[model samples]
Target: MKKIVTLFAALTIITFLSACGGGEENADAEEKKTIRFGATSGPYSDMVTEAIAPLLEEKGYEVTNKEFTDYVQPNKALANGDLDANLFQHKIYLESFAEEHNLDLSEVIIVPTAPMGIYSSEYKDIESVETGSTMGIPNDPTNLARALIILEDEGLVTLKEDVDPLRASLNDIVENPKEIQFVEVEAGQLPRLVDSEDLSMVPGNYALAAEMDLLSALALEDMPDDYRNRVAVKTEDLDAQFAKDIKEVVESEEFEQIIDEKFEGFGKPQWMKEEE
Candidate 1:
């Protein structure tokens, strides 16, 4: 009886050891196989849920998505290592924010982004904008410049000739032909400002989030490649496997099909339109 009991105890100990070893190996295999992707709670998040995550799953990755209501937290979370990746800001905003916050982040893949546009409730067309009308622009510097540039294109405002159009601010404006009084508003609030302000420059993502139609804009921006949003990760992770996977997924034909089917009117980047 004693000898039988000893044999059984030894067998139980061996099984427990083997199970522990297997668990460690399993954890090791999963180290970089799970992606923590973050984005603002809008079209970009939908893109991850509907387009990117599905493709990554097929390639044997487990993707976890987090949606933020604001622009600031997504990048901060990525820098803090709380997220493996994020998509929200364009190249200039991303670079500027990282520099200001002293965080090292980089753009991985540029996606089809919604172009910013001037929206209004009172004015039916750009030609009808009245003199001394109040206009709302984004308070953030990059977008403020972007908004001003679009105004310049429409011949409503003009910046100093030597200033980089992308970096132009209100002070750079040498001419306000319409005598427009531009009010700086938070970017997210511009959609609702349409009724309150004579002209509101709404970013594409915010306009879509507010269920505003892109085609109804008074005028759409001629967005540059620099102004288009991209998937961003830590600078150190730029060469990482998951970053490469994201780039591959974004550049895939299937992903492009998804964009065309759902994200209508979002102008494709120059690189995407190159082969056409």
Candidate 2:
């Protein structure tokens, strides 16, 4: 009986030690000053590289970013615990994707988004373009509406009454004074059509990828808030220290200076403009 009691006490002590060690590990993980950010290739990633990451590093964080080619993977990686935060999506997309995939996600901050713009190698301006011009537009549904909205705003086309701009389609055009012929292609490839088509509506990120100046566009979209891109993280981490830090860095004056210098013509979010 004495030997058995001693054996039981030894087992209890070992279990206690193991539990204490595990608690220490969890504490260490929580205390580690590291952040992993994911972004789509191009200006979004460059935003992190040029400003955000450096700012976090200054605050004693070991920051790392992963560039994704497609939109889907970044959210998936964040949900899977592979990424601490991601910055390539807007609140609408993040919400929609999270609902669709049954993943919990939330927006930390809305960044100044590059707006869709009208570019032309032929016409000098929107008014100078000829009638029946074969215009290049984004083939993807997500961006097609944006291109059409820009056209409407430029007084080139008029959508049917009550047409939701977000869901605007070619069939919704009630009047097109320009007699614009549409050519739909991949959004990312629209920049290449500047030399070939009468006018090409290029998404901003793609234009930056192809080295086109945003100001060079004949007109840039008056971007809606929902359309602006944002930094996202797991819903549970929405209030975490990392998310707060990201918000702080973005709201910094230095961040705006960098955006003005490097990412010219990006439409400022309402909050960002309020600061200006």
Candidate 3:
């Protein structure tokens, strides 16, 4: 009877040990499942660090945010396998960048966007600008086109009727009512020149980075659907589990709440506003 009792006790102990070991192994597997996301500094980096990363961690994902100061590096890192995903560019920009660099990248999901705005430290409003006044715009092709569109909308210029907005250039402008001299500057440098230029068209993200108020813009562009920022991943990894997880998190209520709290003037996510 004593031997049988001892045998039962040993078996129970072995079963408990095995259960604990299994739990440990499961945790180790989860820890090994890390996802590295890259974003430009400022709002993009803040969104991931403040909202997305914590939510992902709660789901047992080890999340890392690799921040870059410029737009070029994030996509480069993603294409080279240094990053699992990136969350810094709009669909048009992503398409342009991938095509230009011959990279196989695709948008995972469209995130919230910051509307581009025309700001002037010297002028009170768009109508106050004088003829021949210079306006600073982004030098990148896509953004320059966007700025020109905004100028057109404000009745400052007229682009050719058939010009593709995504690819439009200063040469595409057929009319300049005010004869505004367009100065193409680096996108990151536009905000600093806001006071110097008669007017400047700034992307919302860059304006925010410069600590400028979004509501203070003389005119804010009604961004086209394609202009919304997106999370991009290597085309081959589009079906991967981590990519799916990222899509889920970005579409969650928690993500929207963070956007509302942290980025009041920034545009809302299209999914949240879309009718169910």
Candidate 4:
């Protein structure tokens, strides 16, 4: 009886250690498998968190969305190993940013460009916008140029023929029918400033953040030459299975549906092909 009790006690000790070892192994395995996603706090991120994330979660991916307020950080995070992927910026912005920051990031999927628009609380319609009326626009280079293009498209202003589309601005405007006054504000603040300014050129996400419907936009951005919005990962990791998973999530039917439903036919941007 004494021998049996001693043997039982030894077995119990071994079993406890084995269970502890198994628990540790599981903890290590879980630690090895984490996917980090980065985006800004806008329609894109909100839609990802609300819509795209669930789809990825269902595929056994552990999705972590790291939200940023500025345009610079998301790509930076993805490039520096802080994030596995980022979905906030367009291909143009990503290309420019990667060049500027010297980061080796590659586009995985081209998402839709949120159609930027000019919104006004004062004017009933775009045609009603008076000459010499004050206009608010974002100070960012790409968006500012896009805003000027929208104005030109509406016959409100004319830009120099030689001015580049990504760099055009009021400086490029050759003739302003009303000598329209321009107020340069941060992209995020344009929507809020619209109440005070005669008109504001706001990005779709910011417009949505301000709770304005896209259908009410007086003018929407024309699809530019390139896909502006996209998902990006480190160039070296582009071929990794995790990177492929992100691309799959980006190109999935569920993501396309989210764009269709939430955007409501406002912005119809193109996607990068599967081969790209």
Tell me, by TM-score, which candidate is best: 2
Clashes of 3: 0
Q: What RMSD does each model have against the real structure?
A: 5.1, 3.5, 5.5, 6.6
Clashing pairs in 3: none
Model 3 segments more than 4 A misplaced:
1-32, 100-102
Candidate 3: TM-score? 0.81
Q: Write the per-residue lDDT of candidate 4 for residues 57-163, one digit (tens) a residue.
A: 87777888989998898888888889988888776878878999999999876666678898898997888988789988999887788899899998998999999
The residue-by-residue lDDT of candidate 1 on 114-187, one tens digit each, is: 99999999999999999999988999888898898899999998789899877888999898889999889899
- Candidate 4 stretches with Cα past 4 Å from truth are 1-33, 225-227, 272-276
- Superior candidate under TM-score, 1 versus 3: 1
* lDDT for model 2: 0.91
**How many residue pairs clash in each candidate at the backbone level?**
0, 0, 0, 4
* Residue 9 displacement in candidate 1 (angstroms): 25
What C-alpha lDDT do the candidate models reach, one value each?
0.92, 0.91, 0.87, 0.80
TM for every model, in the order presented, reads 0.83, 0.90, 0.81, 0.79
Predicted structure 2, TM vs. truth: 0.90
The candidate maximizing lDDT is 1
Better of 1 and 2 by lDDT: 1
| Candidate 4 structure, TM-score to reference | 0.79
